[model samples]
Target: MVLISLVTGASSGLGRVLAELLCEKGHRVYVIARRKNLLEELKKQCKNLEGEVIIIPGDLSDGNFRKKLISQILKKEKKIDYLFNNAGFGRAILFEKQNKKEIENMFKVNVIAYEHLAALVLSSMKKSNNGRIINIGSVVAFTPLPYFTAYNSTKSAVYGFNRSLIYELKGLKVTSTVVLPARMKTGFAEKAYDCYKEKGRNMCIEKFNKIAESPYVVAKNIIKNMNKGKEIITPTLRAKMWYSTRYFGFVVDFVMKYILGPKERKHLEQAVLKEDYKNS
Candidate 1:
């Protein structure tokens, strides 16, 4: 039986690697993202693989597009054997400074689209009573750092969503897994840096760069355990540690306040700007 799969955010970073790996595993993979060119390039690169890469480029945030995409896929492929919901982005800004539309789009893409696509894909998975739902979440979901206000909450919602989904999937071979990963070297970081630049949050991106993990390694490890039947996967040691922090909210809050508070931002601003009048 050929495994049919849908992988979101497959244009770059972890999603790209996951799509490639799924192809390498001889699974017929449908790669989805907003970037059509990159998806085409991925298709070309994986054309010779055992399985195939079917590029479906569109915005996941659009409900109509999502329903149509799945309808189109199920029309041709029969049934979806797996759902990899890895499409999400984060921004660095305080809650008060965050744009209303930006935050709304963030939730629309990160949380709303995730569940929407899952529901669409799960319909097919249920027919076979066999499939997997893999969600890409962040370690920040547990840590809750100050600058990542909206992004953090979305991840928390993902964790809860996955847990509830697991309970509902009981007695079935299908499983729901949420992978929590820490800092990774990907376009995600570049976009996050740009978000900070626009908002004047000049905390050097270098700090994250120093500790960022390789998306290739992270993606490989995640796929390695795809059938291990774990409800949650912390792909790296750092991410595992961060997951543990969820139990200690008070400690996390204290550390976050100390690390990215106004005082720390002001101090970093002076070093980067050299002439801060009175923003703090």
Candidate 2:
């Protein structure tokens, strides 16, 4: 069966890689992002794939843009088999240090937009009777990070949303899978470090360098699990272990206080100071 898949944040990172893999597997893939040039580049590179590829460049955070995108997709394909809500952005700053605009942007992109897009595509998915909704969550959602308060919170919301939505659609053909990934060696960490540097603060870039995994690897794992119809997929072994350990109340509390707490506090202080400098 030829499945029609829609992937948001397909300009780069795991979304782009997943789009390519799905295309190679003979699934019609639609790539959406705000970067037109990058989307075109992806289309060009994916020409060798067996399936069809369509590019729609727009900000998912904009409700009008999402509505337009859905309309366009319906006009072309008439239905969607999969919806991948993968677009997200984050800043490594304390919650108090984050401005109202930044907080709103995070909520808009990570929570509201994803919900709206899923709703928009859900009817068609239900009609297809074998639909999948893959939401890209993070390990931070299970274990909150100090400096990444808003990002972690948003991901937690995604996780909760996926859980509830899956229950609500229990009798339906639609399946919602939430993927929790660890720190990926994508533009995400680099951009956060760059923002810190731009504010004249020296962030511990080496920490990210040590633990971050490749985007391609993460993307591959996500696709592998999605094919198996997993309800919650943790891409890396480390992520799986961490989340598993976190489920134990005493172990999680101990680790949070002794292992991750100090480093997180230090990083958050630096990040908050840097953000303050930028605002000044």
Candidate 3:
């Protein structure tokens, strides 16, 4: 049976790699992104894929578009077999420096859109009696770092959602899998750095540059584990190691603060002082 899968943010980065891989595996893929031209290019690149590719050009942040996309999918397919909630971006700036509009946009795509889409698809999934949801999160969800405060929080919300969904869908053929991946060479960081550079922030780490895996490698592991009934997939050895850090609890926090504290403290202190002056 050819499975039907919906992949968001499929025009680039990890989502693009995952969508292409799904096509090659003979799964009918519905890909959504803001870039129509890139989606067209992906279609051409996947010409030899055994399954059909359907491209939808829209923004996940838009409620109307989300409804229309879900409606179109249900109208055409009996049920969506897989839903990959992979549309999200990173903000690399101090928390006080982060834009309110951008923060709302992140939550709209990362949390609200993900949850809404899952609800929309759940009815059909329950009817069909089988489905899988793979939400692409990050290791930062567990190991929070400075500069990515909002991004990390959003992913942590996803982590919590994925965990609770496992119980909610119990006894059904449906399952939820959350993927927490370490740094990967998918240009996600480069985009994040675009924000970092503008703020004159130093968010770079040599370790991430040295050990980051490729998106294809990360996607392959996620699909393989999701197939094997794994509810939480952590791609790459480093990601698994980072996940293990949760066991150490505050030790992880201490280490993060040690690494990031010096550079970020002054900015946070200044912000606090400014707020205090306004109240006075």
Candidate 4:
């Protein structure tokens, strides 16, 4: 039986890279994103790939859009072998700085959309007898980030939700895995920078540049671990180490405060604000 894969946020970044890789691996790939032009370009690019590529363009933040997307997918493909809940966005700002609309929109896209889509796909996946759900989480979810409060909270929620779902699905044919990675070099950073600039602040470009990994690397690791049916997959070595030490709260606090220090924090905030301001 041919495996079918559904990937959201597939117009760019990790999602796009992963979709291409999966197409190359001979899996029928259904790519979801808001940009029709970008998705078309991706379809063109995947023409030579082994598997078929289908473009599904719609804003994930809209419930009707998500429902329509699932309905259309079911009409075409009877079952999806893998459901990749990779569509999410984040911002680098203090909690108070973000307004109600922004907060709700983020939650809608990052959390609600995933939950709705997962529920839509679960029954089919369960019936398929072998399927996987890969959720893209973040390392920031492992610890508290003062400035990136909402983003951190959403990721933390994702971690908790995926874990609970895993427990509930125990002994079932469907398996769930959460991919946690540190900063990755993608359009996400640029978007965050743009948002900060609009607020007359700049992002910490240098700090992110130092730690970010390519989206390709993140996608590669995800595919590698997914085949093995791993429960929690942390891509980068630094992220793995950081998550491992998160059990020791005192140590994490001391290290982040003293070792990394206030100086670093100030510098990051300033740099981020400056970049944001310039972009704005």
Determine which window of 10 residues in candidate 1 has minimal summed lDDT.
Answer: 271-280
Q: Model 2 shows how many backbone clashes?
A: 0
Clashes of each: 0, 0, 0, 13
Instruction: Write down the lDDT of every candidate, Cα atoms only.
Output: 0.83, 0.82, 0.82, 0.81
Which candidate number maximizes lDDT? 1
Residue 271 of model 2, lDDT score: 49
Pairs in clash, predicted candidate 1: none
Leading candidate by TM-score: 1
Q: Candidate 1's error at 125, in angstroms? A: 1.4
lDDT of 2 by residue, 1-280 (tens): 6788999999888898999998888888999988999989988877887987899888887999999988788788788888999999887765676778988988999999889999998888787776888999998887776567788889999999998898878877778999998888766765554333434544556566578888888888888878566679999988897678666868776777787877765664464365454543
lDDT of 4 by residue, 84-133 (tens): 99988886664555677988998998888888889888988888667899
- Say what the RMSD of model 1 is: 3.3
Residue-wise lDDT of candidate 1 within 78-151, one digit each (tens)? 88888899999987654566688988999989999889988888867877888899999888878876667888
TM-scores for all predictions: 0.90, 0.89, 0.88, 0.89
Q: Output the better candidate (3/4) by lDDT.
A: 3
Give residue 191's lDDT in candidate 1 (0 to 100). 65
- After TM-score superposition, the amount by which residue 36's alpha carbon in candidate 4 deviates from its true location, in angstroms, is 1.9
